[model samples]
Target: MIISSIGLSGYYVNRLVQNSEEIVKDNYRTLLYIEQMQEDLDEIIFNINNKNKTLEALQDYESVLKKQEANITENGEATLTEQLRVGYTKIKAHLEESNADANLIFKDIYSTKKYLNKIFNLNQIAVKDRNERAKKAADDAVLYSSLFALTAILVTLFYIFKIPEYLVKPIKGISKQFQEISERNYNVSLDESRNDEFKEMALSFNKMTKRLQKFEQSNLAQLMIERNRLNAVVEQFDIPILGFSEKNQILFANDRMLEVLQVKKENIIGKNINEIVSNNDLLNLLLNQENSNNERQLLRIIVENKERLFSKRIMTTDTEISNSDSLAHDSIIILDDVTDFIQKDVRKTQFMATLSHELKTPVAAIEMSTDLLTSIKVGKLNDEQKEYVDKINDQTRHIRRMINEVLDLSKIESGIIDFELENTEVNLLIEEALQTVQPFLKNKNIRISTEIQEQLPIVKVDNHKVLWTINNFLTNAIRYTPDKGKIDLSASLKDGEIHIEVTDHGQGIDKENQKRIFEKYVRLNKNEKGGTGLGLAISKEFIEAMDGKIGVHSEIGKGSTFWIKLKTNITS
Candidate 1:
């Protein structure tokens, strides 16, 4: 644009100069030639009319007219100069022919002079026209030149400053972005305002930053997913699990832990564990502040003034596992409730020990006294006295049986029962049980059906103990079963274990009472000739002591099936 403006200004300046030259060379010269002709005409007329027709003056007048003719350069100047030349020629001829006719010569001179005046006036008009044209051209030159100079200066300054700025701005931005990237700032972005390769470079850099941002977000999302999964699992669990950091900051707690602590999960989470550790010795011990390898059991924690027993296991973060899983916790404190089991065990032990030690001698003395009274060796008894003695003896024996059952239960629960485990045939134990309950079987008129498997696998068990548990089951079946009802006894192998089941067609225990049936002195039906309820309880302990599982499958209004499962591993 600037170059074009300069070229245009130069064209306008040349035009102005050419117009000025036309006014000077054409109009001015024509006017000067006309003035010289007018002066010489007056001299020629003066000499001719005075009758002093000097040849020099007449020749000078002719010479001036010829010069005026020659000076006819512009348009219309030639016509006027030609008219003046013709009139001058006629006057000069008249002057030469009749110099004595002054009036006639003066008339020719006056006509020639009128032509000269016409030429001079025409040149004057021509000069005005050329001058006006020159002024317009001059105006055009001034406008164009000013525009050219202004445009050139502005363009030069723009290139000197703005061009470098355009280059350095993006360079600085890209350099600063590189610095930011080195500092791990992935959010820097450049403005892609220009339609240049620089725009593409900015876009590529933006894409790179976007990819970095996406990768970072994806990793963060994965970690959040893992953490949320762990939280969901712990939230739904019933076991009390409390996880904390090394700084004693509680990371999280399960629903059960929150309930046991009587605090909300929101209340405890992110708080220091020391907030809840006030007067909580069990937590302190289980946390292993003493750093002992020993485990803590029977940790009694009181909630709402009600004490609960728990066996706690503390787990610390494994560096190898934590390194593999970034969301792994620092430490976990897990608690298992053992309140009922421990309480029942302690009460049963104390009661049975007291009963066994305190009642054994008195029961024996009562039995001996009743026997002696019945023998009639100390005194002669009447029939009524003898009958009472027999009843007393029966009661004493029943009491002794109940005491023995309690003692056996206490020993079984305490894990103090002497178990002489050996590879024994389960069929033999079933036969022995049948033989032992034969009197009760006959008295109740209950027929025992045996479905012992052929070539039955030998089971590792305490032989006598197994037989005793089987006999207790048979006795209970015989007692609960109606007269003439059939009882089915079967032995089968299941999952590498021997299952001995005794099914009786008797009143079944209810579902609610089934769980408590094996508990001490817990008889579902008191009216059904139950033996102090300790028989089944003691039998359960005995079977369990021999590494066997015993349970009764019963539903209300349905017959009961009692089963004992023992592991089968035969070794001679």
Candidate 2:
């Protein structure tokens, strides 16, 4: 600041000096020219009638006056100098003629001298005025420079003293308190008198410390109560629960878990899970450090000589080692016993068989009745009578179909569905599916096209179930498609699999309904004449059971393309 002030003040001083020197030098030169002009006038007076000497002196005098006129410094000096030039011109007029009257010449010279004297005095006053202004400017420059220096000094000294006290000391106090907080010490204070941001911060810090102190004082008992409550709640859960540290130590074992272990919950706490569980495979799987939080798998544990299925739900916490006081456990292991579910599934399958047998007798009787009515064994029936018989037969068949579908659903869920796999030619399977659905297509006037890739590899699948799935897709396509619409059946060897696609230009399913279309009993727009919505679900089951994939690509108002891909038999 001092240096800058000095530089700026020196800049003003230098500008003033330059301007003042120019004015003073010009004024001095003008004065010298005026004095010389006066001397030349006197010489010219003596040299009158000496034509050469008189003319030379007259020229030199004119030159000096012109020079002095150009250098006029003050406001009034210009007029005074111009009047002197007029007087000199009068004198020159006389000298140029060389036959000039003495009185007229002397009068002109006297007039010239008076004007010159006036001009000189004006310039001298201007010089004095300008010199005083320069001095004043110099004094003002010094005063301002001193003032700026003093202000800078005061600011520097204030910062030097006040920074350490008001800024640095408070900051240091806060920092030291924070350091103490890092060491788990919350008993610290800071100055709170200063009205600044730091004061607010200090107050906040002190409040935080007070809160932390209060928390530290009361935290343990409250935490113990909450922990006990949480433990009790978890213990009351029917499902087993366990918590493990990163070191695989059992931090918590609930009552259900203790029952599974055949030990007291308190006895298992703090013991490693490896020490409690005898199965090394299951223990190693749960204690595997590489297991990520998203990982979950089925595990079996033997209790009282019987094996129980547990869904090993492993959950990892976002606990950082740097935060030693974090409340989060390393990992939480929730063991949900799915043994009852498995048994129930078996019971469900057995119930399906029982229900199917009971319904089969009634269904068979109705079917037999419909057959006899349609036949001529009962009586010769007219056209309307035969139509009623046929309708009754269709209704009976539909009921039977629904019952069969229900059984199939149960069987699929219970994993009891049998599949006869074989290496079947792709084109033959597609041909049989198309042939079965041809009569339905003719009813709607829907055209069929095929694009079977030549020399396609044979796939290993259940031919009946797989063909039934294909026929299901084609039937749906034929039913929903408008009359005269075209359906294309294409089979190809793609990505090392035999892909069969049934594409048709029909009123496509909406996006929201497409995902759930394959689920059990989910139908889109019941207004359309479609089956019980179990066809696609059964189709998905059959295709998946044969290790094939089934899906549909559809857009509303465009069309739908249903596709299936079956794995080809890998040749050794």
Candidate 3:
């Protein structure tokens, strides 16, 4: 558009310039020559009496007239010039006569001046016509240049508004497709019909999306197969297993879990567990395990018209899904069936109770019989008989103590032991326990020391049970300590709890055996002990029943510090 405007303006300007040059060269020169001829005609008429000067003026006029004749540019110009020439020749002939005729010469002079006037008027008219034509050409140049410029501007504005829309529309579509792909949706395809770079880009993008879709399908198939195999394996287990996503959505539930939940698989899988937990009490309890006090507490569930015990186990894992950099937390809740173990434990407790009860009577009778035989009123015996009676009494007393321990353990297991909770002073409790174990301490020749903290808080516990646990700790200390070994008993207020500790310098229990010392039938040193392995175990149960904690810290060759922490009366 700009080039066309420039070309159009240039053509019109060239025409106007040519028209001006023609006015200056042709019409202007003709007018100038006509003015010179008019001057010469006047001179010839004024100086007709002087022949030389008149002839000189006539020659100048004739020379100008000839130039005007050759330079005729307008219509009728040549005819006017020929008339002027003829008129001038007549005037010259009349002027050169022997007897000069002034009247005839003057007549020719007037006619030539008339002819010069006509030529001058014609050239002047031609100059005016050429000027008007040049003005029109200039107007046409301006009008056409402006038209072409306006057209160029309109075309430029059209492209300025429309080009971006044409370019950005497809790019916007492709960008939207990319966004969809980021969200794992590969269903979008761009228009490839465009005949540009965008078309090649679209084709390549479409090919990539197709490959990703196919790869995703293949991976999904493999994942589904693996998932099915895993589910099958989980279902084969006797334990109930349930799985959940980070959003509490149930991902999978084994057949055993579904059976225990008493719901169909379709009802729970892929659904939010929170939604199902509202109507299911057992499920609600299970889900609340994350915040429950006793996470490993056995659940007594009734299944198949019989009571079963299940212990819960929760396992969490971080999993990465395809096309994602973040991790998704998954939880697996497994319920292990311990019904048989619990039933067997109950049966064992029953057996121990019965056996201990039956053995208690025979053991008591023999202890009484030995006491009687040792009495002065019953009989006097030799050293050998005395030694024999003393051995029997000692053996019976140990058997009686073992039986009593067994009986206490059985009662504790059955939850039959009645607790007499009372606020007891720490000093008084330690003193009483020391008195009870004084005979053992004396027999073993063990030294005893007490370090009771002043102003210790009283503990709320079963006084007899606490005393018995302390006595057990003291007896064990005396048994383990060598002859003349020192035993330290201490009580203090610690962290709102009354800490009663017994430190014995003896063949100390090893680190490995310290943990199991409080478990039933776990005798740390088989060759050193003479009583049943139920003392520490019974002590643990007794202290725990009173809402206290018991533990031992020991090292080889050093002493063991057996301690129990009971909450103070105020704290309790």
lDDT of 2 by residue, 71-137 (tens): 7667888888888878877877776674678788888888888888887787788788889999899
**Per-candidate local distance difference test:** 0.78, 0.80, 0.86
- Over 4 Å off, model 2: 1-225, 245-249, 266-268, 271-312, 316-329, 337-345, 376-378, 526-530, 570-572
By TM-score, the candidates rank as 3, 2, 1
Considering lDDT, where higher is better, how would the candidates rank from best to worst?
3, 2, 1
Write down the lDDT that model 2 would get.
0.80
lDDT tens digits, residues 288-382, model 1? 55534565655778865888888787788844443355544488988899889888879879887786879999998998888788675698999
Q: For every model in order, what is the number of clashing pairs?
A: 0, 0, 0
Q: Name the candidate that leads on TM-score.
A: 3
Candidate with top lDDT is 3
lDDT for 402 (candidate 2): 71
What TM-score, to 2 decimals, does candidate 3 have?
Answer: 0.66
Give the lDDT of residue 157 in candidate 1.
92
